[model samples]
Target: MRTAALLGAILLIILGLAQGDSDALGDDQPMFDVRKVEIAGELKYSDPNALQQYYDQLLGSGLFDDSMGNLTNFVTRPPWIESAKVRRVWPHTIRVSVVEHRPLAYWNAGQIITAEGQIITPRRLPDLPLTKLMGPRDTESVVLDQFSLISQMLSTSSLRVAKLELEDRGAWNIQFSNGIRVALGRTDILDRLGRFVAVYKSDLSGRIERISSVDARYPHGVAVKWKLQE
Candidate 1:
């Protein structure tokens, strides 16, 4: 009984000494307090000042008390941030490295889609000349893939895709840079695109400005809608 009691007392004394050491460090070492934060990254859309505000709570905190994982998660909470890393620098500085998502095109309803098919909705959309792609819910990757294919198909031609839409019924529509719209119904989309390209090069390229819309759903040929005499 006496031996167990002595061991318990020794354990309490050891714990008390550890607590005292921690308290002493906190009180006597102002150099251990977080004094500066460094963020390094290529930020095209995200503001560095705004990102620094996330670490404001860590300021004046003892370097030992700050959690690196929590700091990293907070910096990566923004939609534009793809990944982030946080580390303590010596006695008083916290350093963070961040990677941001690169936008590929404008998605439905003011959202931006990245090359890897990530949809991000920032508070304010950026004004870029990128093509617009639209589709039903949960079909972002599908629409982006189709758009890429179509863009590649039309790469040799002078027509640039301004916008592409995949309707709920699976029909595809494309709007060209010159304000001409094309309808490719649910079937044989590539064949319709091919026919349009042939007809455009053979018959429509010279007077493209007068053409309003084209229906490429037919297998044999495409029907062109010309602008009014006005």
Candidate 2:
């Protein structure tokens, strides 16, 4: 009787092991058949078809296979994509959430072209309230490089920019929110802007009504033009 009981116990254990293995195999099988894809947070700049094309490339390349690890790493790091998330839902669908980068200002080609020369198009067609920058058609890259400095200068005060133009002669001009224009000449732009900050802090704070223009091209001085009443 004892021998029979031990043999029966061994048989039960083997059966349990087989059942566990079967369950594990089932869990490891691929879950969903990815079909429809949804994208969100594209804003005004992202092209739905272009984004879909990118995903199709990934899927067709077998990059989505589980044996290859997470497929999201490739999708989220693209230059134009600010952020992205991928989700698999149901057996026939996938969803991709994307946040696209919007241009804060245009460089070189009016408000029509991005800093990279990609034409800027918003979903809603209306005039952009952001600053515009223009430079030589071929010099857009240099202008883009200088955008960081220009952006930093604008951030220090209430002076908002409507447009900033860089002439082919290297001259720089900025139009402000209050109908004021500023000319910072071609040399030592950082130093010239610094001087303007000092003057704004001392002479123009809370006292001036409207300034038509300021010339910071001159060394050791900045010229101001007050707007005349019409």
Candidate 3:
């Protein structure tokens, strides 16, 4: 018991000395210059050169003392970054971790939209062959919601959508990966697609090369246009 008590007392004394050292160099005691900075995250679309330059200028700023406000603001402002966390490695090093936006589909032409309907226009589009979704700027949520529903419905098929468009007149159209276009008109879009799918499972998919377009505006049947065979 005596030895244990002595060891406990020594540990407490050591901890106190360490705490004093921390107090001498803590955030409030003295502001230190950033000598090293590490960025940790799976970043693909964000430019690494721009990131390096950004950090260089930021660390050079004497005003970047201990507050994470500057770093967080700077990192999150980039279109690809969803959120960022900043931490100090005690003396001269700062670490930044970031979460990126997941691009669900391409919007308009150059813009990409997240699954949550947030639009981002990166400097360069990713090389991914994403499905395109188009609609008025005000109808992003509506269009995105419909795209999710349509994509989920098509997931059961052997094929996938290449593009989806919603015109000002509320007409909907989808182009499948096999380059077959389907006009869904205004209402009952998925129901129309289901009708078309029945034909596809029974007939069309095997003859995809001969099919150019499908008009599903009929309540009971769909119209198919065949390609000219040479």
Measured by lDDT, the strongest candidate is 1
TM-score of each prediction: 0.81, 0.54, 0.80
Cα lDDT computed for each candidate against the true fold: 0.85, 0.66, 0.83
Task: For candidate 3, write residues 1-230 as lDDT tens digits.
Answer: 99999999989986776576674455543344566778889987888777766766656333356467767887688888888998877556778798889988999979999866799999899988899999977788888889889888888888688899999989999998889999999999989999999899998878888898999999998999998989
Best prediction by TM-score: 1
Candidates arranged by TM-score, highest first: 1, 3, 2
What lDDT tens digits, residue by residue, belong to model 1 across residues 33-116?
Answer: 777888888988886677787666678877777477777777678888888888889767988788999899999998999866
Q: Tell me which of candidates 1 and 3 scores higher on lDDT.
A: 1
Model 1 bad stretches (over 4 Å) = 1-33, 60-62
Tell me the lDDT of candidate 1: 0.85
The better-scoring model by lDDT among 1 and 2 is 1
Kindly report which residue pairs in candidate 2 clash with one another: none
Least well predicted 10-residue stretch by lDDT in candidate 3: 23-32
Clashing pairs in 1: none
Q: How would you encode candidate 2's per-residue C-alpha lDDT over 34-135 as one tens digit per residue?
A: 445666674565566767776765442221464322656656554456667777654345667877666656554434554444544444333567667678
RMSD of each: 6.4, 9.1, 6.5
Question: 78, model 1: CA deviation in Å?
Answer: 1.1
